[model samples]
Target: MRRRRLPATALAVLALVTAGGCASSPPPPPPQTRAGHPERGAQLIAQYGCGSCHTIPGIDRADGLVGPPLTRFGARSYIAGKLPNSDDNLRRWISDPQAVVPGNAMPNLGIDQIDAQDIAAYLYTLD
Candidate 1:
């Protein structure tokens, strides 16, 4: 019996097809907001350098991974491992993370009331 060899172009096409099948799907789009506040919240997270300690979605430069990832915060039952994950509680955590979780490395970024509220809104939509 004699072995038959495939042409170079045929082998390349087969390789490309196989590789494309193995590629992972793209990530889902970020949650939408009525008032478009998540954009502002994302800005605030960058401005305050929250990525230095925690991971946030939609912000590519935030590679810290030191703290918990905020990908699906809306599904989380608790915030800071204690307080319930509610709008008010999230605001508190963002404004003063240490207050919610004492001895935690996260610092108070001095976020004002409105920014805290916007951040909370954004975090809640991570689900």
Candidate 2:
């Protein structure tokens, strides 16, 4: 018996369909306590020079590249690959990252409780 061959276009379409069938969507981002106050956090971030090590969002003047950016912190699964992502955790990280991660590059900025809370609040809104 003789076999027939599909046209090039038909074969291409089939390949695309097969590849698309195997595609999967990414997981959802982590939840936050409340909407972020990026504006307020922005101010604190600049005042504390957080941009020197870590990157934060909405602060155009920030150019530091030592640490990760705070653009999508609210949705991140972990703060330093060990600590869970949450309002409380974020506050802890902002105030003292070394304590949570141990030997982490982040330093203790001596951020007050209220300022840390505000920073966490702002980070949570990145999503």
Q: Model 2: how far is 9 from its true place, Å?
A: 27
Q: Runs in model 2 with CA error above 4 Å?
A: 1-32, 35-38
lDDT of 2 by residue, 83-109 (tens): 667677778778888788788788888
Worst ten in a row by lDDT for model 2: 20-29
With candidate 1 superimposed using the best TM-score fit, by how many Å does residue 100's alpha carbon deviate from the native?
2.1
Give model 1's TM-score versus the native structure: 0.67
Compute the lDDT of residue 104 as modeled in candidate 1: 92
lDDT of 1 at 37: 77
Worst 10 residues of 1 by lDDT: 27-36
Alpha-carbon local distance difference test for all models = 0.74, 0.74
**All-Cα superposition RMSD per candidate:** 10.5, 6.0
